[model samples]
Target: MLVDDAVALVPSIPGRRALLGLAGAPAAGKSTLARRLVAGVNDRLGAGTAAYVPMDGFHLSNAQLDRLRLRDRKGAPETFDVDGYVALLGRLRSERTRPVYAPDFDRRLDEPVAAGLVVPAGTALVVTEGNYLADDGPGWGQVRDLLDELWYVETPRRLRERRLLRRHVRGGRTEAEARAFIASSERLNARRVELTRPFCTRVVSPRDP
Candidate 1:
């Protein structure tokens, strides 16, 4: 798996902590890949060696989304707290010794839980993944510069869509509702994400070694 290959490269990085960003479209498995990479690195090194921070944690609250009239486009970039997300990454890179708390998104509640995760002091690697990391937009472009390396997870469109449908269903949407969402806004976001692949340090496909 690429997780093993990625873990093999971490020791060569010259830093007390290294940040790795993984970008991919929804359901392309950015979170899954990141979790695997973090686990693999920690297993080889030691516990607390790596932490996973997801950009989904920066999603705006439902009230804020309603105020902005972005409720229907909840997964879109405009629906996230882009500035806050950037600030968190900046803090992660510059601050050491003190514990850095990160938020986590709860699919069941469809909201972000505050201080849901902590990156302990001296943790050697931080793996952050999201759809927008590879994007070249104003706030997003800065994210690339902070990372030691950025990887993109690419999967077949049909397979990705299937995964998304199942995810939505599990998240409380019916199969029809999931398909409709995918056919509508989600697919548009996926297309926009695909445009950023060229900006990534490397691309990882399931077929790759």
Candidate 2:
């Protein structure tokens, strides 16, 4: 769907603070699309009308992952604080009388920084992007339930993989290390995310923007 069309869909949802979720596999352009949607909404509606909240912020710290022995599967579904994410979403929905702060993931630091984004008290829409929003595993189902709508961002496998490799290399991985990580971790996560496509309200291409 066209991003302008997607932007129009946000305010139409019946709520004081509607949450719009953009879910997809890694490097499928969920983050890009979410930023566009939020910017488009705010430009069309008004400043402070929209905000962005990213799910990457919920990723477990490397130390925590090491303790759990899931460091190797860092991007997997089990590597996030799902319950915390769900609780934050609940607050973003009900507590509209004050600004709500949300965390953000820093790729360079490989850690989640608290209160990196803020949703104003009277904001009309919150655009959140992530890989596992549509996943039904454990605490993930509540994420889908909280959002008024969840749209899957679809990109060709080749393009997605290329982007992932570039992202990893930019984050300090060698080309060989990037490819290995993709093969061992990202590929499996992407496949798992694909299974949740049926749960999305819409499937949108990154090219649509």
Give me the candidate number with maximum lDDT. 2
Angstrom error of the Cα, residue 83, model 2: value is 0.3
lDDT of 2 by residue, 163-182 (tens): 99999999989999999999
Between which residue pairs do clashes occur in model 2?
none
Question: RMSD to native for every prediction?
Answer: 1.9, 1.7
The whole-model lDDT of each prediction reads 0.85, 0.88
What TM-score, to 2 decimals, does candidate 1 have? Answer: 0.93
Stretches of model 2 off by over 4 angstroms after superposition: 1-15
* Candidate 1 error regions (>4 Å): 8-15, 206-209
CA lDDT, candidate 1, residue 109 = 95
lDDT by residue (tens digit), candidate 1, 124-147: 778998999988877878888888
Please report the candidate that would top TM-score against the real structure.
Answer: 2
